[model samples]
Target chain A: MSLHKKILIVILVASAGAFLWMEQQQNNFTSGTDGQSASLPHPGHSAPDFTLEQLSGEGLVQLSEAAGNANGAVVYFWTSWCPFCSASMEAVENAHRVHGETIHLIGVNVTSQDSKQAAENFLKKHSITFPNVMDQDGAVADMYYVPPVPAVFFVDSGGTITSRKTGAVTTGELEQEISRLKEAD
Target chain B: MTEPFITWSVGPFTISAQMLFIFIAAAAGYGVMSLYLKKLHVENRGEILGTFLTSLIICAVIYKLWPFILDPQLLISPGNLLYFAGGPYAVYVSAGVAVIYFFLQSIRKKWSHHSLDSFMAAITTALIVFSLGVKNYGLPSPFSFGYMYEGVMYHAVNFYYSWLFLLVLLAALILVPSSKKYARSITMLTGLVIAYGLAAPFQV
Candidate 1:
């Protein structure tokens, strides 16, 4: 056989091998529980602490301090560009109105993709009352292993994560998660 | 640290590590191609440089404009045009344009076979480096070699591709006869097909 023909055959074999491997990997990805929440930190792990500047011109809000004081702290990672965050902010705002005293509701605005001005405007338009911190460098979001916007992590008073929710959450879900965090001791 | 991607803040600008690596790889590839052309006794280095620059500009233009062409509504806003347009398809379009340009150049200028070989070698080298820096994680595996990204384990597809492309580079260097016509085209086609097949499952 010619050298080019032999090379062509080898190429075909290699291509087939790659195709089969990819297919097997795809099956594994689908069959496993590595779904949307795979990128987030798990419950029982200590929450990653961060001190970010509050958007309201208030002093820095540290995660460890907030979690230690309130019944539990709800750390929300969001961005102004995400459409889901707008609706979720309303639910969070309502939850904050009723459970403001018991829980520390802190929003960490991922400013890597969105401007601080845009985030501030979004908060104002939504009438969100909870203190929101500006994660200018996205270090906080990176620490929490946040994948997408509208992610919430519920940490107990001891700073151990109790639960995490990816994407938007309703008022009931938010309340239930907070209650769970409070009962986690 | 475990994630495949990295973002670095330089003063006021945040830059992607992948983009930086790709830029370095392209420059290195051009240098290697220039050296290879010299070794092959192919003169007219300026022509090679011109072709490279033209192809690069054409690729960038097509990459940015192809999206707007497909979706006219995206043209309404500059932000929308930039955000919504051009992804994996842009790479395909760029490669197609480069290949057509090379073929036309070869016909018009009567370029030597060695020049084409050098071009292929340059691409393979750059791709090998590019794969290492880019996120090409495979599915989860129980083996020791698997990479843990975020919270999930993956097969380290980028590492696999880097080694695979290296082998392809070796084959092009040693196995293919230097005098062979269309050797680069054959090697490139084979490499591209294998790469596409390997990368298919990971596409989102």
Candidate 2:
């Protein structure tokens, strides 16, 4: 190839290399796992069921318990370490206060937390009425296809996933989610 | 490696070796692009990259030293070097310096065709270098996602933004003479940098 052609070739190869590297990095950096997140069932797919130790320290709150309520349940995934996750709990509590009894709001707590008591205490202090289930291994989080959280998932009475949000959501937003689920119901 | 280096704050962020590589790659883009300009025998290469690097350093100093930059008696109480990361004016300053750099490039080039690939490569390198800064190595802010699509979109944004920011710089550079090879090269890079910057943002 001529010198000019050589330069052209170099640029094309270099750009292609950069582009490919970028593509690969994007895939890796974004927490992508082939079928890991893809396993996230679309709406209408069966929402996985789980048994979580409730905050009451009494019995486990099974997904089966809320199987057929007129209003579906909202499951929020959070980590004690994340400020955004904590902020999201405040929002969850707020939603509980507004739509008490009508809608079920459950928190799926990740047990990998350094201070489980601190997290629980935060929820208790906030006066959150919803039942919180502990996920020690983060299995439930994977089931929901949750990305680095503060996330929320809405499930219909039939235990099918309806809608979900991944970041900070307000009580009003949760209320909107409830209404949307109710409408779908 | 990523977990301890990473923490959640007011924003979603990343701090791992992989994230480190992205920034390295971006700097490489800067170096490599300069080589190409050299082959094209574009004059004033040092003036371009040197000014660009100097401005970048200034931005970092301002970002980190924001607290000191602020009046001590004032309630704002500015006092650190990492302040630039959180500085409200950081982006504007970086973009502004890039504009000036483009103008410098403009004095040498002819018709600027600044393509997206060229712009993207240079910026990716620049951000990679910024990420390597010792003081404020964590994600500038907290991570968030309201929409399902955002989860996926977030990954692709860094790729797009680096190029876009450079495109903006390139746009500023391309507005000069058209007859000179130096001017032409400068024009192309200017267009690339400016266009890319204009197109990429929310990714950050």
Candidate 3:
């Protein structure tokens, strides 16, 4: 009828379309998920405990089932292909050199053979002394529903994921997020 | 199989603050529309809708460009480029263009009331678009707040329900009339925008 009325109708219709578009795409699972939104949502109420065959530098080790660990576990997502991830591990290596027995620093390689070997060599090459796990099927990656490579999930002593990082994280920021989560512990 | 929607927690709160912002925007827009069109003799509903759509574009551009103008660094940083440009800056640029267009119309000394109505319409559209965009980033889906990255950025079609709710509210605001001792529509609009600003889009 009137000009304003016409615009109102258009606005109404556009919003309806946007809504419908959202409803129809509910069944897909790609790289990202609603459960792990970028803006720092919780790691869900329950943290799933998964034990995977980890190819440790010394030998093959089963992570989450590894006995004799004292406090907590740090599961990092990385691939040998990513330079930044390798660089970050150097810092982790340095941290390991300083506090190897005190804390656990485990790197999980995302579905790459070159990176898996490169990661192993990077540790040996850089003298990265901590244990690194190989994620062949991307099972662990799928479990976290991680957004990207180099995702780090910090789990507390009790097993709940205290904090996680999606993109490349600095050693300092990594340390800070871990410490922040420990405040509640 | 469809992924599950889990509860998002930020700070000490559970409910998204983004929802509050969209509501605030709609509330302000509706308030403004109510005041302007109460007794004014207009052509029909289409003209009003067209005017508001133009205004929405204006507001979105204003909101988008302000940050870039204020701080050049945001546009410069490599990673910030895509999302930053898409977010508030886009809204501002669109608004800037709309403003120039409207001003030119005014200079021609055309139907001033008609032009003003069109301006408001543009703003309403921009607000809706910008709100929905922010929500999709998986920060918080206030309107068409598609939850991205809590899972994956779907190349195919995926949707959200909050958008419907937002539209309904917006529709109600537009179709409903105001009566007795009501503040000027423009005043209400300004107040609502200001309140939404307090919600702080960057806070999350």
**TM-score, every prediction:** 0.56, 0.41, 0.43
Backbone clashes (count) for model 3: 64
Name the regions of candidate 3 deviating beyond 4 angstroms: A1-42, A57-71, A94-103, A145-147, B1-204
- Candidate lDDT scores, in order, read 0.71, 0.53, 0.49
- In angstroms, give how far residue B67 of model 2 lies from its true place: 20
CA lDDT, candidate 3, residue B96 = 67
What is the DockQ score, from 0 to 1, of model 1? 0.09
Highest TM-score against the true fold, candidate: 1
Q: List runs of model 1 lying over 4 Å from the truth.
A: A1-37, A40-108, A111-140, A143-185, B1-4, B67-88, B150-152, B195-204
Query: Interface RMSD, candidate 3?
Result: 13.4
B1-204 per-residue lDDT for model 2 (tens digits): 121122234464533343355446546766855764565454656555565466456554554443233423222423212111222243466556654655555445432333222333355445534433321211111234212331331233333444444433333333333334345445545555543443232232
User: Comparing 1 and 3 by lDDT, which wins?
Assistant: 1
Candidate 1 residues A1-185, lDDT tens each? 67875876587578658658767756775787544323324454467678989999989999889989989899888988886677568778988899889898999999876899999999989999999999888777777655466778888897777776655555656777887877775
Interface RMSD of each: 11.0, 13.7, 13.4
